[model samples]
Target chain A: MNPSLHFRPLRPAVAADGATTLDLLITVRSPEHPPMQLKERPGLNLALVIDRSGSMAGSKLSHARKAARFLAGELTERDRLAIVTFDEEVNVLVPSQPVRDPLLFISAINTIHSGGCTALFDGWLAGATQVANQLDPAGLNRVLLLSDGQANEGLTDAEAIAAKVEGLTQRGISTSAFGLGSGFDEDLMGAMAAAGDGTLAQIESPKQLADLYASELQGLASTVGRKVSIGIRAKHGAELVDLLNDLPLTSAGNHQLPNLRYGQELSVGVRLQLPAWMPNQEIASVRLAWDSPDQEGRKTLIEQLTLPVKPEAELEGLEVDPEVAEQLALLRANRERRLAIEELDRGDLRAAMASIEAIDQRLKGLPQSDAITRERRLLAEKKELMTQDRNLSRKRLRRESLRSSLNVWESGDDNV
Target chain B: MADSLSLSTAASLGSDSLYGLEELLALAGERLGEEVTPRTVRLYATEGLIDRPGKDRRRAVYGQRHLLQLLLIRALARRGLSLTAIAPLVTCSDEELGQQLLQLEEPSPSAEQQEALSYLQSLQGERSLSSSPGSSASLLPLLGSPLSSSSASLSPQRSLSTRSAGRSNVASSRWHRFSLAPGVELHLSESASIPPAGKRREAWLARLLERLREQLESES
Candidate 1:
């Protein structure tokens, strides 16, 4: 029994006669400082995988270099940097060096020139190796790979590269892939990020690359916790239906409990459906269990929480507070709505319009009036954008570009 | 008088005499494959569709007449008319009821009903029953299936008389009227019937009533 144990029950803001019943139990623990005294200045290992193929000679290369310089400036004295530029073959420009030497890093990023076919995989693998070697079990290890063209060289298979990076994620290194221009493989970059336990985003033009990099770097600085896991054991006839932590249900994998460092805070969202009961019958115990590192080498159970279900009518006027659950639901809904809009802009007019309609209806029912208004406006704008044939290319570009930026922001927030 | 006495005695000797109020209500609902709340019992009493026996405030008793009235009320309520609207039609003479119903339906007759009516009228013209006001009776037998016969005698005169009485009572009692949507009129009314099995009877009664109204309107 932790002294800081607090329980919150969630109820819908307004209860209608036929409204669906949603019950949630959220336990907030008092902030506990990590037992171990970790380093105050964490290391940052960034691998800038740039494309130097023949198509990138003019504005593309200029924008790429400028973006690289912007990213270099974001690194602090505690950070380490590496620059890997690729064309037909990969080249290690700066290798793995400390960001303390800003001038050297910027110059190295600027010297890269363009020539032959793009070998995006080679650049990513080279960058991964550099970061993996400099991995401080305590520091944030990341790779930022950018490309203007598709991979057309050795080990060009996107799936194989994603699988390789997925293996790297197991070793605690995360990669963020940025696709530049419309011709590049969006799926390949996205899969790479997914496998690397990071994210993939599309940059329609080189101009947006710097701001994107700066934002990604800022996200790295706010990292509080990583690899967070939550386990729940429901009462008989009850099961955990979903768990969303700022993302939708992508794929189900094995549960991994990672250690939490000092100054890190992680939030987990859970949803459960309990068996229907007769009036006045007590709901059986629902247990929530989680594991985090203690002072010793072994992981300790942080808290085991429980909640009881009572009839909705009887619980009238009692403030139902399921903040975690509500946050999770809101986040999931937002992601789904965003994905639907993306599909719509891709020339799949029917699906896109349908998605907007669903999102519009959902927004109308949301408790947050502000969110509803904002979402409604966005849906309307997207619908208008969909109707104009001339605007198709621009709309597609805008949609992908905005999606990437949003994904980075979300991923950064999740790490916080 | 002797025949009336035997009829009353036989009804009393039947299951009505053996059951308590709660058991009777339960039986009513069970017979109709529904669940009747206490409110439904009160509603039937308020409408005079069910007779409450005596000054025994603690345990009110009801009889077979109550059941019959409930069955009739259920039947009329199913024809897309509100209880208030059905009340007058239920107690009117067949001729009067036919005229009133025809007036109500002519404004916005549904496509299906119009088609059925046209078919029936065309058939009537061939048989030369076209000019008679009483020609509705000819349509009744054609329209009445076995299901409808069990619920209520499709004789328009009987339905009209009952509906007229019900209408006056409804007006005097200030009971609210609930209307059902077009095709759903009969189904919902029967479902919400008071004596429970009233719902099933209501369904059959609805078809017969609809056919009668349609036939009368075509003749007019």
Candidate 2:
């Protein structure tokens, strides 16, 4: 057997940027010999933040209610859930109620009717507050926010909302943002998710809204893992360049650990190009650390992962293996290409075209077989889309449309 | 009076007095208290079995300790021991070292090691040697047997004369002809061995010698 087989990670390092640093305590057990069972069920605290603005009056509101009903049905009796809705004001439909009566919860969701302007910020703030008040540290604390319209009321500023969400996240309440319509700012949704240390997903059409909600809620109810964070710290003099937690880069920091919700496996991909003088020299070690719920309301650190940065030539020999390098390279290239497109959207067509051409050239150099070839074809299509000189909003939509058409998941081949 | 005169004449004869390969082998054999051959000494020297006295390969002068190690190696080989099995015995000195050596020499229960041992066992059978723990001790008696006795058929005096003739030819060759490439030689010794070949060989040798010189320059 390969010596590396024994080194299988019990708690795998979540990729954060391309420089993954994993920190988790692992309990190793052979698959052939099962160990004594730990806890059979983990306690959960989930808050549903629904948008009841005027825009969610028709099929959007119906989908939200149906989704909530589905979520109510999925929850176990031991799990706790709260329902909160907002128009110009926020309302708590169910105040940290146990999942004891499914019909009653379904009635509560059905009773919600959309009206008034969307106060998304107030809605999230109230839902975050409910979670902060009701969540047990031992249970999976999460705030699932679904919005179909823009934030038009109090504290509508994206940065301020992000700040508030960040506070909620620091308090151990992971928030997942679901945008039900294109009108809702994807950037804002992404920022809020980042602030709350959760994931941002878009349900572009009303038809897919219920299914997305069901899938996300069911995933949450499973609750196999909790308190997941992708911890990353660079070597001396090597500052963290950027970070994206299910969204594009919105904030800058030195060290970061994106908080994660239940069953929300944290995976980060990053890239760092060493100073030219540092060639053939090992930079520093990257470490990742995470904590998971142990019993009732307590959390335990699961693992502390470390990977050394080898010289460019020696990177292939890392114990973590070369797949990590390939993934990092792909992510970096994608990010560069995306940023170039963004620049082009801002009227820098020549620069954007150059970046696109560069990416095309790079793709040509890579192995021409497998899914990468398909990706290159899609990228070429995206470049053609950019050549149309579309407006920023149109360009973004077109780019997203092209990306969705590719049928490739955003993370990388690992998920595929 | 005649014997004394002959001895004086021999002492004055510098041509016969010069040391050669066979003479060197006899000197080594005498120091080791064993019959050593030029081939065995050369093999040991090439394999680094014997440590060179001086830093220079060209100027290296082999002597007693090297001859002793050669004798030990030959004795172990005769007893049907592999180089790997005898390596520890040659290097270790403590009483407990013998147990460690034995453990290393013994085949593990693993299938791979067992297979290797089986192959080695078959080869040992061709020489009619036993695989017993005390088999090495039997080599001493075998050294005095008929097989070894016949090895003395060649006159040692005649061997010495032939070797001396070869040495004279080598000595007369130009020093430049023996010049190794600059960076090719790893040793810092002024008298490093040069290759006896072409311009490409000289270029390669120069590169190695230069590399060695660079290391010395850096250290200084």
* Native interface contacts kept by each candidate, as a fraction: 0.00, 0.00
Query: Compared with the true structure, what per-residue lDDT tens digits does model 1 show for residues A1-416?
Result: 21132334465332222222344544334245432554444567677888877667778889999988888887876777878787655677765656664765675666666655676766777787667645555567778888866676545568877766666665557788887776677657766766665646666667877778876765565444443333445444556676443322113333332223334333444566655543333333332232221121222244443443455565476665545444544445545655664675575777767766775676565576554465466556666666764243333433333331123322222111
Least accurate 10 contiguous residues by lDDT in model 2 chain B: B171-180
Predicted model with the maximum lDDT: 1
> DockQ of all candidates, in order?
0.00, 0.00
Put down candidate 2 lDDT per residue, A1-416, tens digits, no spaces: 00001122212322222433332221121123112465544667788999887677778888788888888888877777778888765676665546766765786677788655666766765565555544566666788889976676544668867776665555566788877765677667766765665656666566665566666655554443333333344453444454422232323322334433332323345433333223233333443333444444423232323433333444334354334333333444556655674675587877777776786677676556555676566666666666563443333433342221111113222111
What docking class should model 2 receive? Answer: incorrect
**Which residue segments of model 1 deviate by more than 4 Å?**
A1-9, A12-39, A154-159, A199-201, A244-269, A276-301, A312-329, A335-348, A387-407, A410-416, B1-220
